[model samples]
Target chain A: MAESYRRSRWSNALFVAPYLVVFFALLVFPLFWGMWLSLNKVDLFGGGQFIGLRNYARVLSDPVFHQAVRNTVVFVAVSVPTLVGLGLFLALALNKTTRGSSFLRGLYFSSSILSVTIVTLIWRIVFIPNDGLMALIFNVLGLEPIGFLSTKGWSLFSVGVATVWWCIGLPMMLLLAALQQIPADLYEAAALDNAGKWRVLTRITLPSIKPTIMLVAVIQIVMQFQLFGQALIMTNGGPAGSSRPIVMYIYETAFIRWDVGMGAAASELLFVIILCAAMFQYWISSRKEVA
Target chain B: MADRSAFSPENLTANRTLFWIAAVLAALMLAPVLWILGLSLKNNQDLMHGTDAVFRAPYTLKNYADILVNSQVFGWFLNSLIVATGQTLGVLTLCSLAGYAFARLEFPFRRAIFIIVLFGLAVPEQAVIIARHQMFNWVGLHNTHIALMLPGMSSAFGVFLMTQFFNAIPKEIDEAAMLDNTSQFRIFWKVLLPLTLPAQATLGIFTFLLAWNDYWWPLISATKKEMYTLTIGIASTQTNFAQSEGLGFLSAQAIFASLPVVIVYIFFQRHIVTAVSGGAVK
Candidate 1:
């Protein structure tokens, strides 16, 4: 019996071994390795002198890095509210058992399934100056075409618009699910008390879905903070590097310029921001059970 | 409460208003896609002059024909297929086994290992990507399908989801098999594993979509055009002014590249919705 128990323990270890190997080698080990890489003066070639915190300091001071940080913040700031608010709004509007609601839900969520390349491509044509869709609308309205991808703030805003269109599906779906989870009796009770639609929405609907709202916000923040592909393909982080986010900066630093140490430091900074958002998400999810 | 009755005229008007508003918003959501489709049918010359012509006639299939004739596009599609499918299978196997172990098996340091794996949830890809790229470079694994598929397989989310799923299954089912003197691996293989098919479908679809849509890692690792996945390959094919000079072709490629995911969305809409919402809620 003892021998069989020991053998079973070993067999169980076999079940976990493959995943542990991948988990350690790729996820865990790379984190510490990246930290070490950030501390040294490293590159693609054989150059590794212990540089201490200089890379961090340099990255913190670089104008381009500063711009990337600002741009990333602007993106997260703009898109998170838009995605969360619009998602909740749509969820409320469509939460009813109305005709064609499911089809509309699927229609809204379809863009989220597309790749960033496809999303960006579709938006680029729409945002093109003079002859694109938005420009055509502007022409009909007798307004001048704005250089969405060429101007500075407008460039990043254009990326944000594309991102909202591509990403609104997620928060909408999540919020709609959360809405469905709210017991029907709550609304019935409110109606019995002669509550108005606005009153019921605020007192019952908003409070009921607050946890999901936070979850959506945190998820959007984490995702939007890692703004890489959209900014990369749409504006190419152009108009004098006004729209480049932190991930783009990290990619350019590490891959394009071969500044491994600086890139690692920049990446670490990005991880800190994302980690905070993720932690907030975990916190809300953990508290969700109690709430 | 405005009568608070489903059949009331006030409520009827409100519901109609909401439906109309939703319909308009849905149209706004769909216009870009339809416009792209329209542009894809129009000649590049006609579009270069003005996209307004897309609303008119004289559409052609030449752009799609060009894409179909481009063997490189198919090569990239095949590469994406291999990578996405390989990543999905690997993640399913590794995560299911580990999830089973964490959920049921007795082992030394199991809790510690599980905690470590959970911690991986917070570590963003950007943090490890530089070191990972360099490690792959040192080992000369860059531009390989294995490298493309391996990192994604280290999915903490998969392990977490599968573990929760396994834990939900009552132990009595497996215990009965154990009473028959069946080996533990067989119990997991023949008995418990089959029960987790729904979970597997969810995780598999999520992982497949993620792998298909992944861009950053493949962009760096698969620098060689031959090794590039469809996302990277399609993006690379876009010239500086392809939107103007080759507008129809560009639209065609975007539409083509998105077809697989669109098909998956159409087929697995329920599973995809449940996975997205349930994954977050749980």
Candidate 2:
């Protein structure tokens, strides 16, 4: 019996071994390796030498990194709240609808599945000056065409627009599921109190979905914070560096400029920001729960 | 929730308004895709014209034919297929094993190992890309489809999602299997595995979508054109052809490129909605 038990234990370890090897080698090791690289000046040819916190300091002082950070903030600021609000609105709308909502749910969620390349390219075609879809619509309405992707003022907003369109699907689905999970009695109780739709939405629906709202909020912040391929493909952070996000900056630094130390530092900075945002959301969600 | 009363006038009005709003939102979401499809169906000459002229005469499938006949899109499609399918199968298989171990088994340092894996949740792939590239290069896997699939294969999210799922499967089932002198592995494969089909489908669709839509990592890893997935290959080809072949062919290629995943999405969207929300609520 003891021998069989020992053998079973070994067999279980066999099941876990491959994943452990990868978990350590890929996820854990590379993370620490990246950290180590950040503290050293690594060349493609030459071996690294420790340069301490200079890379972090340099990233702090760099204008491009500063711009990237601000751009990321702008993106999150624009997209995150919109995503949460729009997701909740659509979820409620869908949840309330008496007809054909399941089909509409699929329609709303379709764009979220598209590749960044497809999404960006579609938006690019949509936003082209005179010959684009928006331009055609403008022409029909007797309005001047807007240069969404080309101009400085509208560029980030344009990316934000594409992003919101592409992303709202998942959040909407998540929020809708959350909405469906709320017991019908609670809403009925609210209605019996002579509550209006707005009142029920605030007092019952919002409070019921508070956790899901936080989940969607955190997901959006982390995702929007790492805005890369959109800016890379759509605008190339263009017009005036208004849309180049920190992740793109990290990509440029590590790959484009081949500055491994700086890339690592910038990545670490982004990591810290994401971590803070996540922690903040955790605090907010947990505090409400405790109360 | 809308009032569920069958005959109330107010309820009927609310439902009508909801349906109208949904119809408009759906149109807004799908109009761009339909417009691209219209552009693809237009002749080469119509490519230069605005979306207003997209409906005019001289419609042709020549652009589609040219992209199919004259480009390496077929090869890019194959590469994407190989990677997405491979990554999905690989992630699902590996995550099931590890997740079962974490969720069901008792072993030395299980908590510690699980914590380490959980730690990966906070670390984005971008944070480790530089090191991952060097690691892959050291292993001679650079510029390969394997490299493109590798980082994504062993995701902490997969492990976390699967473990949560496995934890939900009642231990009574496993214990009953054990009474028949059945092995743990057998229970995992034959009994519990069959029960977790919905979860597996969810993970499969999620992984497949992430793998299919993945752009940045492939862009970095697959330097050789033949190695490029559909997105990177199309992006590269779009530049070369945009100035020479005009936007019609590019539109055709983009439409062709997105079709398979889009089709899969339409088919499996139910699994996707439930699974994503599974993570959100539970």
lDDT of each: 0.87, 0.80
Across A74-166, the per-residue lDDT of candidate 2 in tens digits comes to 889989999998887777667654447777877888888888888877877777777778888888899998878778879899999899988
Model 1, span A139-239: residue lDDT tens: 99999989899997799999998999999888988987787777766766676677787777778778888998998899889989988999999888998
The fnat score for candidate 2 comes to 0.50
lDDT of model 1 at residue A269?
A: 84
Docking level of model 1? medium
What 10-residue stretch in candidate 1 chain B is worst by lDDT? B6-15
* DockQ for all candidate structures vs. native: 0.53, 0.49
For model 1, residues B1-282, the per-residue Cα lDDT tens digits are 354554232232235567668779989989999989999998999987888999899989999999888999989999999999999999999999999999988887888888988999888899999989988988999999999999998869999989999999998788777767888789889999999998999989989999999999999999998999999998887658535778888889999999999999999888788777656532
Model 2 off-target regions past 4 Å?
A1-11, A96-99, A284-291, B1-15, B49-51, B240-245, B278-282
lDDT score of residue B202 within candidate 1? 90
lDDT of 2 by residue, B173-203 (tens): 8877777878778988999999888889999
